[model samples]
Target: MDSSSLIASPSLARRSKQLFLGTRLKSEQLDETMLPKRVALPIFASDALSSVAYAPDEVFIMLAVAGATAYAWSWKVALAVAVVLMAVVASYRQTVHAYPSGGGDYEVATVNLGRRAGVTVASALLVDYVLTVAVSISSGSQYAAAALPALSGHEPTVAVALVVVLAAVNLRGVRESGALFAVPTYTFMAALLGMAAVGLFRLLTGTLPQVESAELQVVPAAGFEEPLTTLGLLLLLARAFSSGCAALTGVEAISNGVPAFRKPKSRNAATTLLLLGLIAVSMMVSIIVLANQMGMRYVDPHQLDQLRTADGSALPAGYDQHTVIAQIAGALFADFPPAFYLVVSMTGVILVLAANTAFNGFPVLASILARDGLAPRALGARGDRLAFSNGIVFLAGLAIVLILAFDAETTRLIQLYIVGVFVSFTMSQLGMLRHWTGRLREVHDPRTRHRMLRSRAINAFGLALTSVVLVVILVTKFLAGAWIAILAMAIFYFLMLQVRRHYDQVAEELESDEQDSVMPTRVHAVVLVSRLHKPTLRAIAYARATRPNVLECLHVDTDTEETRELMRQWQESGQEVALRVLHSPYRELVRPVVAYTAELRAANPRGVVAVYIPEYVVGRWWEQLLHNQTALRLKARLLFRPAVMVTSVPFQLSSSHAALQRRERDLDRARPGDVRQGRPPRSFTRR
Candidate 1:
């Protein structure tokens, strides 16, 4: 029944520890250096760019609910969403210029609207970060299936793995600088553009290969009927619009990461925003154009598998329909299958990297919010590599949970998408309009004032467009489960408000004054001694130095013999006062001692009760198991009561010395990668 045998089979424990914790990544691998614009773009903009991979798929999937005739409108919807994205991007460009402190929406809203609005914006962004992980990881898994058919049923596993990889890479160091990100980002844009180009060229040449799923027709779900009414069409369009809005999910990155760019950071960020806008628009429109051209359609495989040919013959029952990009890639790259797989694989990689955008942005925004006392202080600390590490790890953990919960089903997860992003989006745009107006009012120069006015107009338009989309997203997607995201945002908002209030109350309570520096009136020393041990002896000597009206050893007895022996010993020693023995028939020693102390305090309320307890200082971690009971519990309880000060008198045990030596030895040992490689510890850590 010893502590070591109970759970300590050394070989089994060691193996389990290695398997469960895995190998820790070295710190040197994660560089914390500043980034140039090239690296920053892919790091921060990957989410927006990676969104193209899934945004088109979501649009086509939504349109498929109403059959192929409804699919023709997909291109127009894509264009409309693109227009809004451009407007939002233009307005955020203004945001980066005016508010380059990295506060982004929270700052803009707080400055114009006040603290409540800032917290509201912060909450929305926090929830959006959760959705960003869920959406991006789910979609990434879907793409993974397309790229690697063998991994079809393993979506959640793959997505979780992807999250772990991204988290490790991010936690290693801020020095990732988007180096691994560049090719995938650029490749995704190129794949979409190339598909568009080749599709268009083949169309003009009358040689375009048909999409794989083009021959198959999507049967309408239970709701939609043939020859749909105008009202029904409008509702369907609204739903499609809501889904297409996923394209705008990553637009706020520039604002969130204004600090990450090179010199002239704001201007570089604005230009990058413009580039992001153009690239996103081009790819978004191209996918719709190509899908519309090739007669591609997608649907939630859970329903609507009842399609039959014109002759009433059903195609195979278990035929798998590829995604929008997959279908398009299959069609456009028919002459080049390698290109098809390349595009699909890269698309998947980029979608996972898209979450990396959230990874970078979430932590930074969290750190800023934490600095403002709106979040946990842990988030505020810049990690060793100078990144918001707490935020990154937090986001990664959340994404993994969501991925596992939803089984990485993009179809279901998309329902929770865009709610947070658009909430922050519309609020941020409105905040920007106020920002411009405020600037214009301060500036007397005609040109500068006019520029502010122009920016205001752009933001005003963006606010209107985004607000409309926001309303649509709420209305159309609410029943489809957008409510979950909205609820999450509300929870985050209120949680932040509560944290801020708690911090504010603590600050008010803790603020020091001149009275705090003065010494106490007198030091009363009361030592709690359960036995006449070395710890008790040390406490008695230490307490005697204080020299107060009350200097005595307090003991609680559940047994009569031990108390008599102690009393006999105390009398033999002739130490001034008799040892106080509090009775405990219930074996409740702490209560009796506490009551005695309270009785003493009632006689003298102005006096302090500084009760010192004997405690073991062990070297081996498991030594605490050998000694546990009333002492630890008594000290903890006493510390909470007002006017009562509890102190621990350390009595070192043999095990404590060994454990301390082990820790000291660890400090001198070379880290895993430091000696073998010239690079820092993090770089040498294997994937």
Candidate 2:
């Protein structure tokens, strides 16, 4: 109500929010939160679109296991992966249309298959999103190293820093972060598409330059040198196909983020999904084809004969294996070096932005799970920027830990990449099959039934294909590192089940309807006094204001001199309230208070005992530490006693008033539109 309050309040509130979330937004301002298609494409599709940077390399790495002889089939593997990508995109389009609540596979499975199936899908998607961040950022760091040799040996540290930066950006809100990322996403797309076009043009004109590694002969693994057996070839091709399918890992992100779209959410999301599929598949297939036409060979950096000059002699040490996109760019732009650098730079930027897709999808999915009682309820709450802030930080922490553990090596991380996604894809498609089957049972119209059957067929085909890919991925990458992902999924699944169980048990126990609205027989009030001071006098007055059936002032005698002085002061003050001293021979405070409260509760089961403690409300941080520690400890110990309620009679110092004003300003700024929700502004109330 004062001028200083009106001025200082807003400034302090703005400073607090600017320190944390950079800006403060009102509740009504959230209507502008929906994303336009251009922004949404970058946010929801970055993971899939950026996969082209590393998916082809994964394919080539698997093929290199059998040496260059097996590289001939790499394009076939890429094509097969592209087919699966199209199927998944098509299937998820139906999902977004049918269930646009942003739950994606978890919602679909729960609605169609069952709760267990839903939990299974949720678990897999959770693991998939985390791996999406790890693999994408790790690969981005690799591209960074290639672009700047000075950063060659610090990929993991660079990757962690990138994650931290991304976490900060996303904390700014979905639409804001989306706008921030749009340029990089689109530029990366244009760079890759332009490079692919130029590479294809040169190839058609028969002027395509050979990659640096084209002439280097790959030394095969021990068992692969001789003529391949039937089983050996099948296993090798399966590995290649499985690795190629990493391109499909992030296709579900659009489905998970359907709610973040503008008007006509489902249609926009489906369109985005289609665009993601087309762009990703085209770039992936084009990169693999160009790499093949240019006779490029990608192998593990530690592989034998990875580098050889035109004379077939070994090149010098510390030679980095640039990524698939980098190699293709180098080959296509042999005469124009900047084009290659442009491609590489954009590739690295996009790969880092790729994690933004996971940042968007994971928190939304976790929010849904939290709403359904599977995750911590805090994850369901939005922060100052109206984003699921807790979930975002949780994901960033998990990803950073994984990056540190794996040293940000894409080769090791990619092995753990596609397993969870394929599990989610297979189960989601299967759930959709059941969804359509149930719909067919209800649709009496012939035309509608026909459409249902068609959708069912599509989902069924997706189910079969993804199921087979899941099996192949599991078998081929199990020991190679996929087991880590599988174990993670299993752990999340069981943990969520336990969380749901705990929530259920808690709900059942807290169910109200009570024993005919029974009331306590009487109210017994106790004032905890440390000394005869204004705070103690205030506590006594508040206790008297309650007009309880019984009232007493209690003090714990920790020191004889202090207790005697307090007794003499009470007598001299002529206080009517009787003061009782409790002996604490062990020099304890909280224990004696807790025991007395418990004893009172036991003695009067039908009565509610209210314990009022005097507390100091301080503004400064160190001032807070100087006071309230004892009051907080006592309150914590007293809360567990049945039929006992603890109250704090706070004595506000001058500093406390300042803190109160700042808090009021913050609340006012944060909930400016709370009146629309029929709630009054937050103002301090005094008794």
Candidate 3:
């Protein structure tokens, strides 16, 4: 049989895969997969935008520890987060233009700082991306539970299911996933922004009403029972600001995904970054301001002990504490039930889709790492759909583990959230600073120098701000959960370094030398025979066709009767090759064959011993277990012998023909990415 006949066709599993992930795309369609600005905005910016659903709540939750009195600082904290958000956005605008190759912060750090620094940034971003999916999906699950009470205790399950769904959508291809996600992202924007506008209008017109929690009192925590001093208040606000900086989580995604954008990739990416910053900051500040205006009080969902009724008593038996956005939506659309549900439902949907940002960014980052030999090469290869499927599945698996580990609790996961992002943020800003400084040195043109100087200033400010925020996050959250993220980053950093080292060592060891061009002195072919069957005869025929200096059939005397019968059949059939038998007192088939091949190699040290073993090509998977047991074992042993070449001579069964036909049909079907990969469709006729 020809080599093509050995190929297995599409099975039931492949059909199921195609059913879920959609049809595979040819490589030439990669350009068609590039995203327009509209789709790219939602795909890359969803995490940042979706943070409005929870970031403001985190601010309120932190301040609520000091009782409702501390709520006065909520707007200021939101303002701080907004300022940081804008700075990050502006800094990354420079990044997309400077490093439009989609390396994002890692590329910047590696180029301007060093490989170690780049790896540091890459590690941080990788951890951050996993946390993004974890936090976003967990937060979304929380919102989902609030909307559907039946789902309250099942958030982890819901979160995992959501992760699986998102991964499947992403496996379809980047453009397809983006197109699917764009609507929900835009709906979230409109819903939240619309609620903000309406809330602001009501406040101006003196028609605004208090939220359901307005009458509830926020009881002080154990340490904050008394009034806080200035220092205490400063520490409290710092913690709140750090938690609120979740708004900045997805900003770097745009920089990392510049290559995915359509024409004018850099400009579109920068514009998307600007839009993300504006929309996110506006939504976040609006939610905080509106929550404060409506006398909204929120505590950690798990810490409901801190919340009390107007009577200062925990009297309610089944009172649900909805999310900050839910409360705001309820108040703003008190009479409009549909609008309220719309806002809340879309909030949940967007939070789930927010993880899509990580889905898009993580795989691209992993692929880049793979290309640089810092990650597994599989991560760098495009799947049937032209997406980094391995990286996508890997990220999903990590995120699901994190979600389960944290019990899909957003508050708990949020504590571990921003540390890695801020690490990447700080490193990226520092790298950009070095980048602009180096550019300024090279640019003699007056206009170019001026532009470079302006960019440098932006990066300088971003560096200063992000460095401060990183310090605050470490101080306020290290014990809370940020240490876990830091440790994870450290682990990833070490792993990537080790992977790169391994690849380098392998390349060095495999480097061609002058001796590689030399040929062996002669070929000594040996065919292993177990019985006088068609497969055994085929193996002998193939081995003889090579016209080796010496040809022989090797049989192990595992069973004396079988060996004698094989010799009788060999003589009766008048085979051309000489029959040789090795005695096996232990009744072992593989060991005797291995000993003979090693003896042959040792005898003719400069010559090669080629061992051809007959293998059955069975169509059914179960049929495989029934055949080729001895040949497999023998080949495994022979492979380690010096100057030995192991070859499988496949004898096709009738069942294998079915597999060959199926394989041919699959080959005839044109796949999506084939044209781009220079593999055009071709017809095949069975021989």
Comparing candidate 1 with candidate 2, which one achieves the higher TM-score? 2
Ranking by TM-score: 3, 2, 1
Question: For model 3, where is the 10-residue window of minimal lDDT?
Answer: 1-10
| lDDT by residue for model 3 (180-298), tens | 99998898899889999999999999998999899998899889999999999999999999989988999999988988999899999999899989999889999999999998989
Tens digit of per-residue lDDT, candidate 1, span 409-501: 877888888888887888888888877777777899998888888989999999999899999998998988888887877888888888889
Off by over 4 Å in 2: 1-16, 306-312, 658-687
- What is the alpha-carbon lDDT for the whole of candidate 2? 0.86
Tell me which residue pairs clash in candidate 2: none
lDDT of 1: 0.78
Q: Whose TM-score is greatest here?
A: 3
Tell me the number of clashing residue pairs for each predicted model. 12, 0, 8
**Root-mean-square deviation of candidate 2:** 4.4
Per-candidate Cα lDDT values, in order, are 0.78, 0.86, 0.88
Model 3: lDDT equals 0.88
Q: Against the true structure, what is every candidate's RMSD?
A: 5.1, 4.4, 3.0
Comparison by TM-score, 1 against 3, better one: 3
